[model samples]
Target: MSTPVRSSPLALTVLALLHYRPLHPYGVQRLIKEWGKEQVVNVGQRASLYRTIDRLSAAGLIAVRQTERGSQYPERTVYELTAAGRDTARAWVREMLAVPKREFPEFPAALSNLLLLPREEMVEVLGERAEALDRELAGLDASLRAEGERGLPRVTMLEAEYLRAVTAAEAAWVRSVVDDLRTGRLTWTEEALRAFGDAGT
Candidate 1:
């Protein structure tokens, strides 16, 4: 089989937006921000957005519908999704939702090196993180409630739901670990540490 047209998250995002209608890059950027996709799509710089659009065009996923020009401002190129782009967008969404990619999240990386610090220090730091997760979960809950009041169905807000669920799960696990540490249910004695490996380099 021929190689698949690999799409970056930004490229797919642009394709998905263009699937709605032909729009200039500025419109794409605006809709991304307005739709709260900024959390997932990192279009921090306009150059990045332009670059993704260029890539999508080169990949035959998007095409320039027209360029609007006026003496009042610079010319703007309007883009729309091609048939291939529409199919790609639908396929990308399905793959992303169904496949749990191996993401290199910092929490797991930090957990792997957690023994570098004293158990007490680790507990203290994790307690702080737990607090932060609580605040984040509360904010998400409020946002979900507000969106529901505005008639946004849960299906449309599944991303937020996933985030909330993940955060809640992490918080619960952290609390359990904290309780175990405090009650001495989970710990390593000095002898056990030395037996397993050196406590110091």
Candidate 2:
């Protein structure tokens, strides 16, 4: 069998961010924070972000410029994407659009690993995630509307609207899942476990 292609979402996100312009590690971090404002991932786990940049540079998708030392006792490595990197970013975006959405891994993993936690705790976690998604969707919708009213270039406007739609869909899905959990429509019982096992095999 052919090996499955393993790629990091962080790397993909980094490439998409750089498609607009070249950026250093600091710049990427700033852009990610800006994009993820009012969403998850602001809990000071930026190591994954930096590691993705390093991995992309090692893969030749991005190149590190000369290191610049700050006034403090540290230095920073600036990076810029190559032409191939830009193409890769565009291609990844298109591929993502072409794929169908399915249940993500993390949610089930959380449920399965929550053996000791009460069911109410799991429901609360889902509620929190749903709320976060709603905020992100609102932000995306506002941004899209603002950009659309500005009459920007068609390509740019299209991308903004597309992202807004994607975010809205995710938000809707999250809300539905959370509602199911809260209303007893869904449960992580043995039957559910069996169903998952059968579906997997």
Candidate 3:
């Protein structure tokens, strides 16, 4: 039986890249960056990428195509997707696109604990976040325009476009919430908070 590969964003990314052609770990990492996939997948740790590759190979999702050696470095193993891997890649793409899974990202988790911080400090920090989001939107806008000018297919930049849309929406919400907080429209007293907690009980 084929060993079951653990599903993760990185694993899916590796499988998708391998679907194209055989690639060594270094080649995979390089292509991820060159193709701007780092926006969706985190490949900051080379060790993590290597570990994922080992697991994929162990699971028979990918197989060793060949090993190439360069004079400057150690032997590099090229890997290609297996039949199961190709099918898994296709399934992963379909599921990820179709289903909106409940992912616990840091921002929402932090937001849940927002009341722990001082109200004024919350406003200040959130204001900073709004500014950062604005800057991000501007940069993404430029990238989108540049890609469009270069006649890059929209399919290729869908993630970037999604990111820009999300950033814009978040910025607007942050600004509105900050204004509410500053204007005393969304205020709470210690008594009110304690009562709210007691009500939850």
Root-mean-square deviation of every model: 3.2, 6.8, 1.4
The top-ranked prediction according to lDDT is 3
How does each model score on TM-score? 0.86, 0.54, 0.94
Using TM-score as the measure, which candidate wins? 3
Candidate with more favorable, higher lDDT: 1 or 3: 3
Instruction: Give one digit per residue, the lDDT tens place, for model 2 in 74-185.
Output: 6877777778777777777677679865757676677667656676886787678878868876877777676567775657556556666766777688678668767889
Report model 1's TM-score to 2 decimal places: 0.86
CA lDDT scores, all candidates in order: 0.85, 0.68, 0.92
Query: Compared with the true structure, what per-residue lDDT tens digits does model 3 show for residues 124-193?
Result: 9999999999999998999889888889899999999999999999999999999999999997789988
Query: 2 or 3, which is superior by lDDT?
Result: 3
Per-residue C-alpha lDDT of model 1 across residues 54-163, encoded as one tens digit per residue: 77778788888999998997999999898988999999988987987888989999998888988899889999999999999998898789878888777868877888
Q: List the lowest-lDDT window of 10 residues for candidate 3.
A: 1-10
Rank the candidate models, highest TM-score first.
3, 1, 2
Error of 2 at 117 (Å): 12
**Which ranges of candidate 1 are over 4 A from the true structure?**
1-5, 70-73, 197-201
Candidate 3 colliding pairs = none
